[model samples]
Target: MTAPGSIEPTDLSPLAWRLLRIAAGYEQRAVERELDDILQAHISMLESGSRALSNRRRQTLLELYAAELSPEQVTAIVEHF
Candidate 1:
């Protein structure tokens, strides 16, 4: 129900934030231990624009975090970074 030109929940890359929040609340070590899967440092790298991700990775993150971003927002972020 965003008005025209209004900001949406997927306006920014909130997946990283959501992931960190989940990790902080649950098990940080388990998330960090996934081989070939970046964790806390991945968030830093993303925020710093040091690493770009594949489309599948983006969707995987969204699914893993169980975030509620809209499809529009998801596509926007996936295309953007």
Candidate 2:
């Protein structure tokens, strides 16, 4: 078992991405605007597991959500996902 507040290494699933965005205080529309290339519909598809997250998008999300998540957690996500 891991210590308190530590994240377990695991795949960065669509649901996990959604949760991270929500936890970071961003609405889907806001994230869509930030991503520029991605539309709200595409964001919805990504969160719903109907679309795959490209590496570029994943890196963007990591940057976007960095403030809300710890560096260690982000590293774990990047390494294991």
Candidate 3:
């Protein structure tokens, strides 16, 4: 989903779009309860660009995703997002 004022994916900040895509993929692969509820909520807010991620939240999310994804995939996400 695009942000409130964003008409397309291109309108999203690079990191926001990447996070959204990653979240979308993860959502398709597992149930919501598998993810940290706060992180999930933050991701939803991110889809609308209504809130920015805090450094602590970002690190927490990375740790959670890293636990579920391959190292290579985590590396790519770290580099890009």
Among the numbered candidates, top TM-score falls to: 2
TM-scores, all models, native as reference: 0.38, 0.66, 0.47
Report model 1's TM-score to 2 decimal places: 0.38
Cα misplacement distance, residue 70 of candidate 2 (Å): 3.4
lDDT, each prediction = 0.46, 0.66, 0.50
> Candidate 2's residue-wise lDDT over 1-81, tens digit each?
233134332346776677677767788898888877777787788779897767677666656876777666555544444
Order of the predicted models by TM-score, top scorer first: 2, 3, 1
RMSD of every prediction: 7.7, 5.5, 9.8
Q: By summed lDDT, which 10 consecutive residues of candidate 2 come out lowest?
A: 1-10
2 versus 3: better TM-score goes to: 2
> How many residue pairs clash in all the candidates, one count each?
0, 0, 0
Mind giving the per-residue lDDT tens digits that candidate 3 earns over 1-79? 2122222223345464456457536662242465555555666665466776665554444555555656555444444
Error of 3 at 32 (Å): 6.0
Off by over 4 Å in 1: 1-30, 34-36, 67-81
lDDT string for model 1 (1-81, tens) is 333133332333645444433533434454456424757666455545576555455444445443345445534444453
Error of model 1, residue 21, in angstroms: 4.7
